[model samples]
Structure formats: C-alpha cells, structure tokens
Target: MHQLMHADLARAHLHERLADAERQRLAAYVVRVAKARRAARRAERAREQAQLRLRLLIN
Candidate 1:
C-alpha cells in the first residue's frame, strides 16, 4: 500500500513537470511568431518606400 502511494506521487510530479514544459514551449513559439510578423511588416514597408522612390524618379 505504501509503494502504491509512492508511485502515485511520482506520477503526479511527472505530470506537473510535463505541463510546465509545455507551457514554456508554447510561450516560446508565440514569441517567435510575433518576431516573424514584425519582420515581415518591416520588409513590406521597405518595399513600398522603394517603389515610391522609383515612381518619383520616373516622373
């Protein structure tokens, strides 16, 4: 009976650890996605600026 209780405790600890790791992993993914979106927006703005300059030079 004592062994069974120890096993249950161990299992609970392992589950908690896994849950923590998953949360950390998800957080990191969100940060990476945000960074990627910001980079994409910067690139788009740069492209637009370049196009406007070209049009001005042509006119």
Candidate 2:
C-alpha cells in the first residue's frame, strides 16, 4: 500500500513538471511574438519615413 502511494505521488510530480515546462514554453512564445511584432512596426515606420523623404526630394 505504501508503494502504491509512492507511485501515485511520483506520477503526479511528473505531470506537474510537464505542465510547468509547457507554461514556460508558452510564455517564451508570447515574448517572441511580441518582439516580432515590435520589429515589424519599426520596419514599417522606417519605410514610411523613407517614402516621405523621397517625395520631398521629388517636389
């Protein structure tokens, strides 16, 4: 009976560890997506500025 209890406890611990790892992975993914979006926004702003400069020069 003691052995069975220990086995159950071990299984629960393993599941907890797996869940924690998944949470960490999801957090990292969210951070990466945010960074990518920021980068894209920055690039878009730069493109707009360049276009504006070109139009000013043409006029």
Candidate 3:
C-alpha cells in the first residue's frame, strides 16, 4: 500500500493539470485501479477455466 501511494502520487504529480488534493485523490484512485485490474485478471482466468470445463463436457 505504501508503494501504491508512492507510485500513485508520483504518477499523479506528473500530470501538469493535477492539484494537491487531486494528487491525493489519485493515490486512492491508483490503488483502486490496480486492485480492479488484478480482480479483472482473476475473473478472466476463472472464465477461461470454466470455458475449458464446458468444452470437455461438450466433447
């Protein structure tokens, strides 16, 4: 989480349009975005396994 915030802040601060509060908001945003991405990947793998099982059943 620490790295998350640090990386988040650094990324946010890079944006010329970002203000302080916006940068802080970006910390949470970044964390959530990363979490969502990880969740999506897990879901994708699960879906693929389900499809494989369905294929086996069909055969």
Local distance difference test, candidate 2: 1.00
Residues 1-59, candidate 3: write the lDDT tens digits: 99999998888777745676688898999999999999999999999999999999999
lDDT of 2 by residue, 1-59 (tens): 99999999999999999999999999999999999999999999999999999999999
**lDDT for each candidate structure:** 1.00, 1.00, 0.91
> How well does candidate 3 score on lDDT at residue 35?
99
Where does candidate 2 stray beyond 4 Å? none
Error of 2 at 4 (Å): 0.9
lDDT of 2 at 5: 100
Q: Evaluate candidate 3 by giving its C-alpha RMSD to the native, one decimal.
A: 13.6
Off by over 4 Å in 1: none
User: Per-residue error at 13 for model 3, in Å?
Assistant: 19
Once fitted onto the true fold, the runs of candidate 3 whose alpha carbons sit more than 4 angstroms away are 1-20
- Model 1 residue 19 distance off true place after TM-score fit, in angstroms: 0.6
